[model samples]
Target: MPQTCFELCAGGRSRGLAEIVTGDGNPRHKKVLQQDLECDIVGRNPLHTACVLGHSNIIQEFAKYNVNMNEPTTRGYLPIHYAAAWGQLDALRTLVELGADIHAVNFLDEIARDIAFRYAKHDCVEFLDWAEAKHALQTFISSVQSAVTEQDKGKLHKDEKLRCLSACKAKNDWLSNVKNPTRQDLINQKQLLEDTLLPYLNKLAGHPEIVKSGKL
Candidate 1:
């Protein structure tokens, strides 16, 4: 079968791709392409094909249109998976920048990094390792921020207050210890924070008077 018009346009990364997709009056073609355009051969959509071909220019075009970066192929492999498998570092970074989920796993339960490793793409693995660690740190930071808000504003029993305060102090200490820390440092510190706080939070959740108590 010949390549779909969308695939040709995407593979070429031409402005014509956008023109063709948007100018189509059918609407369904654009919708189906954006959401799910499965290829019988590779089960890859335009975006997936762009990644496999390391067509960063085409990917930038998709990013402009806010294309679905996480769209999975027939094998449940996302564009990032193809980028990793092909050791396309620029494409991988572009995907991540455009909000691709680094944690996304394929049908084989393998993440992008895992696929990179399987292919012995050492540089890709290194970049993925750093990206994963950075993502973990950012996630931990967001969680800690939310936890802090809960500690400060959420109603808690007096005993729970002390526990929250302790957790806060521990969080502060962990922050203080890290001075321009690397990704591994953040990973380790995040684990420590979780260990110190999660149990206390769980225990506090079991308190009988939690809901009844008003904000202190």
Candidate 2:
């Protein structure tokens, strides 16, 4: 039997929400979803119900409307927790790809991966492992990119502000004594000294006539 939108939501029908909506950005429909449509049996929302039922298509439809994947139940269990507990591999994978927190803990202080492992869902456990590794790699890449950008900015400032050869020589002498200095360490030292040195360097470079006359 094809349940109506209200009936399906209230009853936790897995295919109800997706089948009802046009997915064309309807405001009324969005409002309906935003409401607390609790399933009488399980007390879960439409998205949570679909997750427990392992309905990937329904989950995708919910995601189209920017559904909250981390929405917790009364028990503080997220959709990811249900997906793992029910051994719904596809549902779990879809949630992970959509940026759900794989490490999120439930009310019982149990993570989704731990629940899947306890339920002996070996495939889900393996998928979670891969997902975690992929996330870590992406974070590392982003940090490296930021560091490169900072280094470039530091080099530009050094070139523009330190115009006098004597000023440059003084900076080099200070850097040579810093133990275990990395590229970032050099940039930090340059930034710390920039404000103090820029004005003096600018004065010396501007008054070339005074410097040539050797009048101190």
Candidate 3:
């Protein structure tokens, strides 16, 4: 008789490797790993660990076996995109060095940069910005446009206003320390700063909380 045990490796709990690489890993992975490059493994195989456990180390292991680091996930996002979105800076760098195509439309870079910013990982946010701009992807750049449009429509909230202000200032300070940002990136930064002013101005104009909080 032969072994027949297998384990699931979705984004939820899949550590990324043990289920696929480890010999003692899930038995079903053997066939999946052997699939051709064009196979639909994203939904079928696991992408969770592709950018995990230190982007550099995991990518290292993949390189040892000549895995396609640039391969897209089930949703069309490359492994670097996964690394970017998940705050895996080491992983992001590894994929890049491994020749992962950074210019591709990666939803993870857009989503992950925001996630990193929200968590105050300013370095990663800046890296994503540079990478996107260098690659001319315009993914994160478009997000700035969308945020501006929302603010101009007066559809933004208090927290959103604060976040925009922070992002704007941070973007400016970051640019001043590096090579000059493109006109588009700088323009977007200015717009974000201007957008922050509106909500604050509106609140100040009618400051209902001023009388209630007693701290104002």
lDDT winner: 1
What are the lDDT figures for the candidates, one per model?
Answer: 0.70, 0.63, 0.52
lDDT of residue 98 for candidate 3: 73
Pick the winner on TM-score between candidates 1 and 3.
1
Model 2 agreement with the true structure over 24-94: per-residue lDDT tens digits = 44556645544534444545677777777787777776687677888887777888999999899999989
lDDT of 3 by residue, 149-212 (tens): 4544564575765565466457546665757566466546545544544454344434454233
Off by over 4 Å in 2: 1-16, 22-43, 151-216
Model 3 CA deviation exceeding 4 Å by range: 1-48, 53-55, 107-121, 129-216
Candidate 1 vs candidate 2, TM-score winner: 1
Better of 1 and 3 by lDDT: 1
TM-score of 3: 0.40
lDDT of 1 by residue, 18-124 (tens): 55456454556656454434554657777787887788777877777777889887778999999999998999988887888888998899999999999998888
Output the TM-score of candidate 2.
Answer: 0.58
Error of 1 at 51 (Å): 0.3
Against the hidden reference, what TM-scores do the models get?
0.65, 0.58, 0.40
Candidate 1 Cα deviation (angstroms), residue 214:
28
